[model samples]
Every structure is written in C-alpha cells, then in structure tokens.
Target chain A: MKKGMGTITAPWKQLLLNALESNSHLKHSSYFQLATVGCNGRPSNRTLVFRGFQESSDKFHINTDNRTLKIEELKHCPFAEICWYFTDSWEQFRISGRVDIIDGSNPDTFKLQQREKSWFASSVKSRLQYLGPNPGLPRISEHQSEEEVRLDPSIGPVAAFCLLVLDPDQVDYLNLKNNERVKFISTLDVNGVKNWTSERINP
Target chain B: MKKGMGTITAPWKQLLLNALESNSHLKHSSYFQLATVGCNGRPSNRTLVFRGFQESSDKFHINTDNRTLKIEELKHCPFAEICWYFTDSWEQFRISGRVDIIDGSNPDTFKLQQREKSWFASSVKSRLQYLGPNPGLPRISEHQSEEEVRLDPSIGPVAAFCLLVLDPDQVDYLNLKNNERVKFISTLDVNGVKNWTSERINP
Candidate 1:
C-alpha cells in the first residue's frame, strides 16, 4: 500500500499543491464549490471549505455535518464535482470524482480513526459548530443560540461531525495566463491499481 | 407579459441584490460556480463570470463559448445549478433551475437582441475570448496562437458567443454568522402564473 501520496506523485497533484501554496495569502482560496445531484433529481451546488489533503493521498478532505442536505444528496448520488479557483494565479481546477462519507456508522474502523483525527485537528471554534443546532433548520431566537456550548473536545467526533473524502478521477486545469489548459485522468486497472495520464489541451 | 421584473419582486431577489451590492468591492465576487449534469451521467462543475440580471427580471445572464463541453451537456439535460458565496457578508446562495441557451441559431428574435446587447456590453478584452482558437482542443504552439486576432468590434457577436439564462425555481440562502437559512421556492400554475413562497429554515 502507498499509505500516502508520498511516492504516488502526479503532475496535477504537485501543480494543485503549488497553487494552494501560492494562494495561501487569500483566505477564500481554501473555499471551493461542490456540486452534487440532489435527491429531487436537480443539480445542487454549495460552497465548502477544503479541509486539506487526506492522509497524504490524492483524496481531498472536507468536514461536513452528517445532518446537512449534502449528506442526503450524497446518499442519492455519490459522484460529485468541485471547482477551485485560485485568484492570485488566475487558475481554476475542476475535479470530478466519487465522494465517500465517513461518519459514525461507517463500518471501516480505520476510516473512523481518520474521522476522529479530523475532529480533534479542528480548532475549538470549529468543533463547536458541530455541537450547535442542526443546519438548514429554522433559526432559533438569537438569545437561545448565544448560550455556551458544552461539547468535550476529547470525546472524539460528535454524531453530526462527518468527514468527506473526494477520490478524484478527472481533473481539468485551466490557467488564464497565456490561455493554458491541461486535462489529467486517473484510471484503475483490473487489479485495482490506479494510473494517471495528463495531456495539454487548448484553452 | 411581464417582460421585466419591474413589477415582480421576491424577498430572496432583494436579498441577493443586497449581497451583490455589499460585495462589489471584490472582483471575484462576480464569479460563481455553475454545475450541470454531463452527458456521461456525471456532474460537471466550472467557474463562470456572472454577466448580470437579464433585463430587469430575476433571470441571471451568463456568457459562454458555444464550443465548450457545457453546450453539449446542456443539450443532454438543461437542468443546472449555481452557487455564489459572498465573503464580506459570509452568505451563500444556491440557485437551481433549467437553463436556456440563446445562440446564433436561437429562433427567438427577442433573445437574439439580448445576445447582441450582451456582446456590445462586454469589454474588448472580454470579446476576444470568443475569437480565439476553439477551446479544449490541442494547442497548436505558442507562436501561432500569439498572433493578433482580426475580430471586428462593430461586426457584433461572433458565432460562438452564446448567452445562457437561468430562470431559477429554487433558491437556498445560508448566512453563516448567526446560522440562518431560508428556502425560496417558485411554482408555476396551469395558467402560467408563477408564485414564490419563502420559509425560514434551519442553518
């Protein structure tokens, strides 16, 4: 097992990492738009914070509340696409792949460990978000929600705190400078080995 | 016919207008993520510049190159979604609905007039994007593509200039500060009368 993205290097992954490094000055650079097919059969889109790369692998990490509509949408369709735009470099990366939701009920124990790692890795302020009232529900009176939360950080992840991992199969990289574009594709062989191929295309 | 949104108004529309007004200082605020169902039965996502509201109505205007993959994807399925996030206000609006592509071949004369209006409304640099080599094709070398284009400004929009109109049926608005959310839904009756209903939802 590669165990990490250490030896499993790809040109696009390095390029993405470089883009993130260059654009780290802007706080919004970590934000991306995630698109999924909703349960209603319509395309649904939302903004999500990129948690980071997951365990040194090509997969991306994103934390979400299990109770959110995206959870249900992912259940209906696991395939999703995310568009990340780097303002400083004038580059856009559109990654399309399958999303695996690792929640409390996930049968894989190792995956659950990663969930807990992500939970504790979050700041106290971020962890408090998962302890609050469910998202997308009618807002309670401001006074009521202002009360202090009693979530214990050492107790592991709360029920609502879930980790989402996007295993990308295709990447469309576009740079506005000089109108450059590239497409990176990942294919799995019969033995379940993944291979990456990249091509430079017109912008 | 209500040719414009002059007499028609909705709470969500007003809120969206306010969000845009407050965030206009950011150049990237005008950019949003648009997602469409690809012909391959997967979700396709990309970043696009928002032209503005169509006429004075609620429909959003977006310009695209007719040669892009989205043009073919739209033909396969017209449903699409857009996610716009405001940094200053920390608000997100997810708009989902059917898209109507108005290109050179569109039969609607009124829409063609709108297309022309959009063409002239764009700056010279913006107009040049459509005059280049076909997007997504293999690059033919930097020297050849570096040659100046001979596009005539007064000749109007080129064949590849296309205008996309998204008449939204649903808007999911979320404000992260106080964890407030609202759902706005539009339904059309048998008599072709459209009605909008809004509800405060959990955040």
Candidate 2:
C-alpha cells in the first residue's frame, strides 16, 4: 500500500494507545530512554517515565528536574528522541521530536499550566524526587526515606520541577513478533500546520 | 566513599557484569536504546542488542547493517549513547561513547576480523536480515518466512554486515532499588590511556 498523510496530529497515537494497554502489566513499559545531544555534540541518554500525552493531542509529557544534566543539554539543543520498548508484545517505538522545556523561567502561561497540572497529578513519591537534592550530586548519607516522604497535594510544583513537552515529527514503530516496521513522518507548512504521513517499511 | 580514579580500564565493567548475571533470565535485558545525532543536530534513537564487551575491555560491540540510517548518522556524528535498563533490580546504565564503524570498506584487517567474528557469532536469522531489502524501504509482501533460513557459520560477514565498536568515556549508573547513583568518568591521557573516576551520586 501507499503512504497516507494526515493534517491534525500524530498518526501513531492509536497504535501507541493499543500498545500501552497490551503491556499495562509491566511497570517499566512506561519507562523509555530520552536521548539528547550534549555539549560538543555528544549523545546523552537516560531512562524516564511517560507522563502521558496532553489531552488527546500528540504532545507528550515528562516531568523532570531543572538541575538535571538533560535540562542543560536541552537548553543547548532542543532536538531529542525517546526510544520505548514494550516487552509483552515486543513492540518498540522510536519517537524523534523537538522538546520544549517549561520551567520556572518559561513565560508561556498555557505551558506553565500544563506543568502545574502534571506536578499535581504525580504521586507523592514521584513528586518527592523533585524535592530531593539535585540528581547526580554526591549523596551525603545513605538513608533516603522512601517511607517518610510526605508532600502536600495542594502545593504546586517546586522551583526545580520542570515539564518537557515533546512535539514529535517522526515515529518508528517496530513489532518484533514479526519484525514488521512502520514509519510515520510529520511535516509542517508555512503557517505551522502539521501534516503526518505513514508508510510500512522493511525491518 | 569519595570518588575513585583508575588508570587501567572502566571500573563499571564489574557492575555491568554483575547486572548481566542478575538479569540473565530476561531476554530483553540484553536490549538497550542507542541514540545518535542526525542532521541539523536532531537526535535519533532505536533499540539494539548488546553483543558483550571485547574480552576484558569495556569496548562494546553491536552489529548493524551498513545501509541502515544509523550508519549514515554515525558517519556524520559518531558520538552516541546507549541506555540499558535491568528490570529485576531496577538498574539503568547510561553509557556515552564514540562509535567506530567497521564496514566492508574499512581498511583495517584487524577491525574487519572482529566484524567477521561477530557475523559468525550471530544466528542464521540475524544473518538473513542483512540479505533482505534495504531498511526503511517499502515492504513488497507481508509474509516474510521467519523460518527456513540457513547460513553456514564458517562463511564470512556479508557486505552489508557492519560492526560498531563503542568506546565509552562516561557512564552513569543508577540503581532505583535504593535510588543510589554513581557517576563514572573516563578521561584519555596524552598517551591514549584512559583513567576512570567513580563517585556516588544522588538519583
């Protein structure tokens, strides 16, 4: 079959939803590798949890700390990609997109609202990670109370808390059961309108 | 403890070996995400299988088709990172390194020998993938015979078969079991000797 294009949003959203449901039993299914180009064009990657999409749109959500190295890397280069694998169905999704960081310094009110909403939606344990000392910093003591962390749900996101929204331009969906692959590409027009095209490719 | 410096080789090799032993039951534990920078500084990522280290050294091995997109991406930018997550112990390793591609065109017989050895080590199914049409091309048929593919192991690597050697300079190991993180940095001295330093860090 020929490639098909769309104008509204990412075409792989439905397939991704199906995959998520199929592999809901695995906790790490939501965990994916977020890769960014660091200083001097070196590649940096880390595992992060999927915070779901914004409403029904393809704009992805990920809550991170501003003090993390990725924040600095993203500041230098906004282009990034996330590679996610679902072991149950043996599905792999490589999504390449441009990341927009909404931190304490962001001026966009709408983006800030989304960040606020994400922070409140997270579990107390998840929110407490942001409360801890900056990631990668030397740990002074061994005891970090996984049991004692208590954050007020009403309190908004702290200063270090940041939200990353990835506007995906391409997605490579591969199923290892048969090693079937599909590529979905999205291009923008002059007025900033996104058009998506999907094609079945050899694995 | 404070940071440690080693002049011989990567200190994290022991930890990685321990991880591999602990998660030997899970098949996908051998899989990880490899991220590379594409044109215009964009980031691309995909899943790949780990082919173990080179003898006692930390030099990583991965086999890929030369015609794949990463071969071109690596040509422009050899810097890449592989993020591996172990589900059993909740450990993640982020290894950032420069990749050396040893394809058919490679001049070094030594590197080509390694490539040949890797091809011989791979299964018949893996070897047949390279014989198929180029990656990302439209699939002409849906049924690709998964079985009934046989190749003699004594034969050498095909022209499309390529070996990737990742010489890591930095490794970030995070154990979510206790949220304990360690940063391993390797610096090359003037004589091309690598010195590794490790420090306990916050997750």
Task: Please report the candidate that would top TM-score against the real structure.
Answer: 1
Candidate 2 lDDT, B1-203, residue by residue in tens? 00122336578998998999999999998999999998767888899999977655788999999999898999999899999999887999999898999998898877787888899889877898888878988988777664655666677888999999998989999998877789999887886678889999988
Residue A199, candidate 2: how far off, in angstroms? 1.0
**Per-residue lDDT over A49-160 for candidate 2, one digit per residue giving the tens place of the 0 to 100 score:** 8999887578889999999999899989998999999988999999989899999778878778889999988987788888787788898877876566677878999999
lDDT of 2 at B23: 94
Fraction of the reference Cα-Cα interface contacts (below 8 Å) that each candidate reproduces: 0.85, 0.90
- After superposing all C-alphas onto the true structure, candidate 1 shows an RMSD in angstroms of 2.0
Interface Cα RMSD per model, in Å? 1.4, 1.0
What level of docking quality does candidate 1 show?
medium
lDDT of 1 by residue, B1-203 (tens): 54644336756888899999999998888989999988877788999999998876788999999999999999988999999998778999999888999999998889999999999999877888798888888776766553377667798999999999998888999988766789999888676555789888776
TM of each candidate vs. truth: 0.94, 0.92
Q: Please, what is the whole-model Cα lDDT of each candidate in the order they appear?
A: 0.86, 0.86
